[model samples]
Target: MARRERTRHLIELGGLVQKAGLVELADDDRATLYGAMLDCAARVQADDAGTVLALWKRRGKRAFDAEETAEEEQR
Candidate 1:
């Protein structure tokens, strides 16, 4: 993906995270998310559809982890 597109995706994901009340993500978690986003974006830019999809899958896992952590904290 283009730089602009990558930035847009990151912003979109950030919004989703905020709405999910997962804004308390640790610095390491945030970095991981950002890094994954960047990796996927780069893959897309390189026209590697498979790699992009894989990166997105990884990103989803990270998001799930964040959500689970937040829920656990409420208990």
Candidate 2:
């Protein structure tokens, strides 16, 4: 996974997210999607520990938020 490939993957994910309709997503949902995209990008950009760490941090927050929301809804 080279840098160029990683960038391309990110761009594609972004396109998918847009196509899915950003307006339909709650802020937390959008954040979750963003985190997923970043994680994918990091995987494609292998060996870049800094990038991986950053994405993980961001994604983790979003994922946690989403989970919390889901739990609240169930309660």
Candidate 3:
């Protein structure tokens, strides 16, 4: 059950990548997609990691909130 849950979690993360249009933007190139993620990881490892992470968190939260609002309006 734990393994299944983990698999689902990973799939949802992949869905976010697709939803973000990275898959299409990279033309389905796995290497490029991974490199982009690596760059994000590097940014989080920098001296201003906290500030960088906070900005990303805020942006992600806003995006999620906007998506939810749009879905609710459609309903």
TM-score: which candidate is best? 3
Candidate 3 residue lDDT tens string, 1-75: 999999999999999999899999999999999999999898789759989989989998999999999999999
Cα error, residue 48 of model 3, in Å, equals: 1.3
Residue ranges of candidate 1 with Cα displaced over 4 Å: 1-46
TM per model? 0.39, 0.35, 0.93
Candidate 2 per-residue lDDT over residues 4-30, each given as its tens digit = 999999898776566446535735486
Better of 1 and 2 by lDDT: 1
- Residue pairs in steric clash, candidate 3? none
Evaluate model 3: give its lDDT: 0.95
Number of the candidate with higher TM-score, 1 or 3: 3
- TM-score, prediction 1: 0.39
* CA lDDT scores, all candidates in order: 0.76, 0.73, 0.95
Number of the predicted model whose lDDT against the real structure is largest:
3
TM-score of 3: 0.93
For candidate 1, write residues 1-75 as lDDT tens digits. Answer: 599999999899778766655455544387766676687578788887887778868987898899899999999
Off by over 4 Å in 3: none
How far out, in Å, is residue 53 in model 2? 0.3
